[model samples]
Target: MKRNSLLLLWLFIFWSVLIWSAIDPKDYPTWFLEVFPALIGFVVLAATYRRFSLTPLVYLLILIHAIILMVGGHYTYAEVPLGEWMKEWFGLARNDYDKIGHFAQGFVPFMIAREIVIRNKVFKSRGWMHFFLLCFVMALSAFYELIEWWVALLSKEAAAAFLGTQGYVWDTQSDMFFALIGGLCAWVLLTKLHDRQLREL
Candidate 1:
């Protein structure tokens, strides 16, 4: 299929799934908010598609990240169905779905950046690229923490759901730490695989 047609088809599927999820009786108000970012990302990706095609692994990573966000939105992270069940099964203190979402926010984006840098040959130093990628993900994770703080300051109720910390005092630190791990893992796992895919492209 042509790139434009494929892009349109993906967009159609994305919006269709989002709409269906939104109208579902069990859906949370935050679900709509999650879709907003995915829509924005989709527009950006579509605009750049002609200039750059993502590897299949990168594409799958993006989809996984989107699903994580959507699922967190559906149940407000702290109360996500899967996490709740896992909590029960494992006898945990609280649901940790938000952790999964934040981790992917770092992990998937790391690969996205990796693909961009490697494909475009953005920097001469591969080591520098890897260092910068890790730092970038950490910075993003920290910025998101600040956003959560700001949201908490603005509205107590909304912030409760938004933070999804579930009374964990060290949640912000832990979130960033997980992001760091994710960034490292992404570099370790996808670098060579991505390079192979780039060859095919």
Candidate 2:
């Protein structure tokens, strides 16, 4: 596809999901909380389209992440049908859809960070760049936990749905761990593919 045609298709899908998610979501506030990052991503992508277009792989990954956010927004992570199915199928204690979100939190953002750092020559040493990206993703995950904390403090009713902790005491720690795992996965798995895409860019 031509670049413009591809961009149009991406925009179409994004808006379609955004609109669907907004129509009678599980809860307006929770939906906003979940989808706000996707909104920001859209804006950032638009702003950088001309001056700093991303690799197609990165764009596709961002779209996937946005879809995850939109779906979670529509149903709330704890009640997503897919997660419910997984819980039943695996005999798990609770819905684990939120874990997927947390994993993507690191997975997609790590690659985005990697692209920016490498393209901009932010760090000379590969080891240092990798270390920084790890810390960056971990910090991002930790900060997200703090946001959940603050939100729960403000609204007790929405806490369970937003955090989707499902009575697990170690939820916060585990969420960060999953994000760390995600970051490592992105670093190990996508680095070569990302490098090739970046070269094409």
Structure candidate 2, residue pairs in collision? none
Off by over 4 Å in 1: 1-13, 25-29
Candidate 2, 14-100: lDDT as tens digits? 999999999999999899989999999999999889999999889998999999999999999999999999999999999999999
**Candidate with best lDDT:** 2
Candidate 1 has what TM-score?
Answer: 0.88
How much lDDT does each candidate structure score? 0.79, 0.93
Candidate 2, residue 192: lDDT: 94
Candidate 1 lDDT tens digits, 31-76? 6555566767778877877787788778768777776776676667
Worst 10 residues of 1 by lDDT: 25-34
After TM-score superposition, the amount by which residue 164's alpha carbon in candidate 2 deviates from its true location, in angstroms, is 1.3
Instruction: Give each model a TM-score.
Output: 0.88, 0.96
